[model samples]
Target chain A: MDQDQKKETAIGSLFAQWTKSQADLWEDMIRMQFGMSDASEKSRKNPLHQTQKAYESGSKILGALISTLSEPENLESALKGMDSLPEFMMHITQQAYEGYLEFQKKIVEIAAKIGQHTEAYKFEGIDQNIFKVWRDIYEKEFRQYLNVPQLGLNRFHQERIARLIDTLNIFQASLNEFIYMFYIPIEKSGAVMQEKIEQLAEKGEIHDNFKEYYNMWIKTLEGHYMTLLKSPEYAEVMNNTINALVQYREAKQEVLYDILKEFPIPTNKDMDELYNDLYILKKKVSDLSRKLEESRGV
Target chain B: MSQTNIAVNLILKKLAETTGKAKIKVRKASEVLLSPLDTELSKTPYEVVYKEDRVGLKYYKPSEVKHKYPLLIVYALINRETMLDLQPGRSVVQTFLDSGLEVYMVDWGYPTRKDKYVTIDDHVNGYMDNIVDFIRKKHGLPQINLMGICMGGAFCVMYSALHPEKIKNLVTTVTPTNFDTDKGLLHVWMKYTDAFLMGESYGNMPGDLMNLGFLLLNPARLILDKYVGFFENMDDKDFVENFIRMEKWIFDSPDVPAATFHQFVTDCYRKNLLIQNKLELNGRRVDLKNITMPLLNFYGQYDHLVPPEACELLTKAVGSKDTEDICLKTGHIGIYVSSKCQREFGPKIIKWLKEREGEPKTDKSPETSRTPSGSKIRRETVKYVSPKKIIGKESKPASPDLKKAK
Candidate 1:
């Protein structure tokens, strides 16, 4: 092989040798930083299912709440069993936050290394973008968290209380998965950043072809992704987050529908009723038309 | 151009490729962008042979037909079946057609609120059954080859298990039959999912919500990197058109029927009933032992969504003696779309089906095919390592054949 061809092979081999041990270490670091690595099977069984019954009419919901709240510090006591905002906002989030910082360090290192090798495209400090994504998600989630203090037990209205607890549960779940959530964009950005390397490879920045460069990135990214995805923590957090959101939307929708019913105008429910009636009528008409046509041999 | 000038130009052209080529391509991009592009899918000359509600059976007549039995493609409800016929040169349907394989794809059309009552029984036994019967009657044959993709593959497995008499050969690509494994996060999340509540609340599972969850599975790549990569290659007309086609297929997901989703999660995913011979549909048990047809189960080596662990167990769990599991060197969608995968995937199925064709059709009951031959899985292809061995070792991560991933 020629000198340039040899160089490309060397670069390709550099990627092929990336060991599973390295992937495990990186995955562990990311999970540990987020407190996801510490989540046990016991922690996954958070009493989230019991909240489903809280979306009933105010009377039933209030009756259930009253029955539960008869015990001293019951709701607060249950909330205590789970990690509060302070635990994450103060202590548990530090390692995860630092993990993002470490991720930025790696991004910088990878980006600079590729930049030095190619001139087809300039990778202008991609680490900054990763950090920006991290900061933005954190800020947005914090704003969502700030809405929680207003939903205190002072509001005894059953619907409002239901929405409050559900919303808090979601907010708490978000806090728990904050690091991993932020890391998803980062995990994907690795490929985006690889475009710079690809441009370089095309422009003779690197002797190897763009396809080789892309495969290297895929191998690297897939390892980190597969490791995280296979974890019990990732599964638990994903399950909790989606379940919490589904419940929250259900509760909010019910409460909103009630308020909308108070108004004389059409709400989602009124429109849904009208639509359902229309659909059934349409189906009946179509079926009858089909029968008529078939009878006439059309 | 003189020899000296030519020599200088050769060196300069190489240098120009570094930066000059991109500028020239970008300048040409605007001209192509203004004109209408043909990004049409399911365009391989298919006619709707039969229609049942929103569901339609699209038949694509091939240029040449050498096979005895017709092949039916059962695609997942989550996304449109147009991925099979995505583009002119890159189409899976076209590939099969070029190889003299008659193709029929099931278009599980968009579900509405009215479809909330549709269950697995309604799909596997109802719509799919009708379509299979239609194909059989159309061909004047008793049985036809059945091929299903993703969720459709799961349905094919169910259908084959339930009615082994109707299928000559079964090919399930990127299908998840053994949902008990925790390797795939979808299985885990579904296990914990309150499907009953979600079903009642939404009527039908929202397509947008499903897309959001899918995007989260690989946020960095799916949400950001994909589009950015498209932007990077926007100058290439073919690349841009292909990107647009893929984008259309990806976002064109249909809402799943609520009852179907609930049963799928509860029975198949949470309870792990199907593989264990406990799932009941239409008052009859969906015994896996009934999947006794000549089986070719294909999965993407790098499929994170339906990991090999989720798919690999099916070859053994089923009672098929002629079962072959081929792990292609690509991810889920890439199994059909990727250039490298296209070379091996379609041809392999064509060959596997042809070998098992025109055999004396024996219509056997579920109990007759329950003979276990778990070790009969053929590993003749490139590097067939057991998914359990790789996924079983705690520290070692699953490594797909990455050289061919793109």
Candidate 2:
């Protein structure tokens, strides 16, 4: 055969191999979807079942393209199959928009609940309830997106970015909770001071000395803060906040390492290695010097 | 007059008075704030005699050296040693100097990333040991008076145990030897702290973060009330100057080396190993029973950082029979800075040291000597002895001028 004919033959075989692999993957996916449906009636009613159905439809289109490519004579059929690509993408986009809308609805519902609680002056429950609501929403609805499996050559980098984002969110949430806890003392102290002032007013003994009132309020605030700080709940929240911060910083450092790798700037990993070596060398020298001193009886 | 009218009048009168006072205060405050005030810390002149990496030795020589052995004061790495010499009147360094006693202090300079691997062992056995040896050589004495403040006290305790012959008199102020207590918020929090993770993450524990933790311990006082006090006393130049000085000192914190911090929090705070004498440095166990020298321990009664519970047990745990623990009625910083404590704390320490201050070594015949306890001791002239020889010895004070501390 001529060189051109040989090259064309080689390309045809490569395309056939690619088609076979894609066909096998689609077939396995279909079989898994059917198996899942058959295994549990409950799973068939799940949100993931809808995703499987969408995947099944996309798989049919892909199968058509694969067959047309393998047959080589069905070029027109492949072009016809390609026409469904935009529709398939639109279907996926619509699902995503609906999911986003659902998320927004949940957030608005929680926000409305918070507004109602605040309007009623239920200060005691407001902080706790708000923190719970936000934390629950993030963990249950949004955290999974950050934890989703990534793919391709940039999979690790993408995963690091996702983790960094996830950790940042977690850190902010914990920090907000901590700040709210800190504010509770102020709120409680204010209520207590107000009660004291009201009692003084009732007795017709309200003092003109503002310093005394300030002292009273400050002391009450301090007492409340002391109680709050000493509590196990406060300790737990503080620990969580600190841990989240550390995790976020670590994630950020990892991402920075990737970015810095392209630049001439030495990363923390490089410096740490150098530090370790220097530490060892210094320690060895110190030990030897000490040994020498001892041997010399100096 | 009607009740409403009387109330209105009263309110108006109070408001008028407050406004007048505030105007005067503001005018005075502005003048005071703008004035050049001496808020400088460590005002007592001292020369840097030795330096090792980031650490330095500050020597504050007296007009006349009254004591035979010079004192080596090791302040905590958490804060600057300038706290001792905050001001002329309140300066602990000055107090020691005025007593005609030679004073030497360790300035543990700021730790960078390179110092992350510097452990407690490096501190107690390495820097401290070298400093002690240098002093011993300088003075031609076998041992010197060793004093430690706060975390530095912990290091001193470890050093004294490891090299008993190198320390004549051991004094620990606001030192926490026993960490198995919930009296202090620090102890409680440290118990739950992931020290290893913190060390690994930050390389060195940042000082600002520690200060933040301290502020959180008493937010109403440290954060709010402190600034409130400053604002209220803004008109008083002395108060403002003193406040600024204190502010400078408090915030002038150095990062704790990561490995040292990790080991301290783990071995001392988490495990409570120091009191148990289970703590080890440089592969050698720090046995409290090895500290045979006279020990004077002081702790503040209201010290939230290092409570009496964290310090009082040290004297009882030590091998020294002449151990005294004085619980001063003050907070952590107040024990040194408070005017009331200035009278009691410095005088008491000087008196205690004087009582235990042995005679100077001379080339004359060996004479009989008396200890602070009024016991007669036979003098013996001897050459320099190795530290290892005196490590585990249970020797008592044979002579006041003896080279061996025991």
Candidate 3:
């Protein structure tokens, strides 16, 4: 009934409530995951069900520690319970790591199949699925880390840095794709030229003049390039590459602006504003001079 | 001998010859590259007569001026006007001068950061109008003959529409006024280009980037075959000089003013406003019907940048009764630089302008000049006369007989 005892009892009750809520939340998650009303016999055999059980046991151990700590005489027992915490966390982490490895293995298998299909010439363009996979993986897994809600006085600066890094990666990927598209024409032209030369050789029509071959190869390359460049696919990729480059440049300029704020040299933003103002002022003067000239009939 | 043995022997023989030729070519190329070569461009003697910010006006007065009105030429902002006077034998400016025509060309100097805000209106109405008026005042005339090249041609068209009284005859060469056609890769790509984003991000549309785009239009030829051809002909000194001169001109690009680039792409390329006469510059619509001057529109048949489709429609779109569209048998730069076109292109324009010279300015009233004035808009009538026919068996100077009926 004394103040210290009353405080210990209140703390004990709070810890007990927390432990019960945590257990209830785990049970609800397991049930929802299994689409079951309760943790039935069938559900208990599930790996997630085992995970729920482990969570419950961990919470129970924490509850025991809280109760033991509340009673000053059982402080040793509470410490012993705290010693088991690391082991419990290891078990949960191990399970999650195994799950991630399995997922990655399946993705790798799918990616390998796509690679095979691309080599088999199933698709017309540079294998975009590989790039798509990389982008999807980054977007789904790593992008969230950079996009995590930043806090503190330097949060804006931090976010800009993050954006710069993100845009740079995207721009580089798009550039790679664009370069690959360009390489396609050269590759096709070489292959086609080789085939043509072989056919000519077989027909015993091979010319001694190497210039003929050079001309044919170049013309073929130009034709291939024309077809590729005019395609909607190439246009789309070019636009995407340009957009990525622009975004990267803008993001980089923003970070540069922050860095250059302390320097004596003017940044593009500063110069742009000044240029815009000067442009307007000069235009007005030019217009006025023209009007004046017209009025004078000169 | 067996066929395989014969083929192997032939290959070996060809390889030996190629190696021998390459060695000689490399030595000759090194000598040519190291020697004091006359590879300079714009060799025609001219004086810078007027200056306005980054723009300059070059006056190339013929020894004897034949026409009553001086011909003012406006070159595109994309590249330096040095292209017109690339070399002694291949210079368009020289051809005009030889024909006793006084030439005034606009040298749009390299734009810096300050020039990023220069718009189409500034180019067409501001600088172009000022230059026209300056020429008119200097010559003591109400109007002067105006000619524009590439994007400059588009500017001339706009100027002629806005101020018809100042242009006695308007000539557009390799201009892309009707950008709606997808016959050229530039038109197709420009439709997808984010011009505003490009302008805002880079401040000015970088000349180097534009060159890269141009190279991509035909990488096989521009990037690959061009170098291969150079190496093959490295032993020829004349070829080397001409090639080097052209290389200098091709790469000597100037950054386009950002605002002008944006408006051109949006109004002309994407919206197809210039051809539709819906393009507005400085609150005034560039109504094609306002162009009442004798219009001579010339385009290259093989021009990949500005196809004949893009250039041929301007003559029909204009209000001028005396409009002619000449589709030269060449590419964009070829129309000006190619030896074959040097005979056909310049002479044809001179003849057309000569035919309309000294005529009274057509009244600008809507009812007066817009109607059929008996002068027909000639289309596909001028054939590419053989160089042998024009330059006769006696090796006479080549002159296109514009009066000859096909």
- Count of residue pairs whose backbone atoms collide, per candidate: 3, 0, 0
- Pick by TM-score: which candidate is best? 3
Candidate 1 CAPRI classification by DockQ: incorrect
- Candidate 3 residue B100 Cα shift, in angstroms, is 2.2
Alpha-carbon deviation at A181 in model 1, angstroms: 4.0
Please give the DockQ score of every candidate, comma-separated: 0.07, 0.22, 0.28
Models ranked on TM-score: 3, 2, 1
lDDT of 2 by residue, B1-406 (tens): 2232125567678989999999999999999999899888888999999999999999999998888889999999897898889888888888998888999999999999999989999999889999999999999999999999999999999999999999999999999999999878788788865635666688789888887888788777667766666677789888788778877887878999989988998899999999899998978999999989998788866677787899877877888887776766556776787776788778777877887875443333224444454332332233434432331111101111101100
lDDT of 2 by residue, A98-122 (tens): 6567667766776775523222122
TM-score of each: 0.61, 0.79, 0.80
List the pairs of residues colliding in candidate 1: A33-A96, A188-B220, A188-B221
RMSD of each: 24.4, 16.0, 13.9
Task: Give me the TM-scores for chain A across all models, comma-separated.
Answer: 0.35, 0.62, 0.61
Off by over 4 Å in 2: A1-127, B1-6, B359-406
TM-score of chain B of each: 0.83, 0.86, 0.88
Model 1 over residues A193-292: C-alpha lDDT tens digits? 5675556545555532344555456444544555555555555555555666676776677677667777888866666677668656765675587689
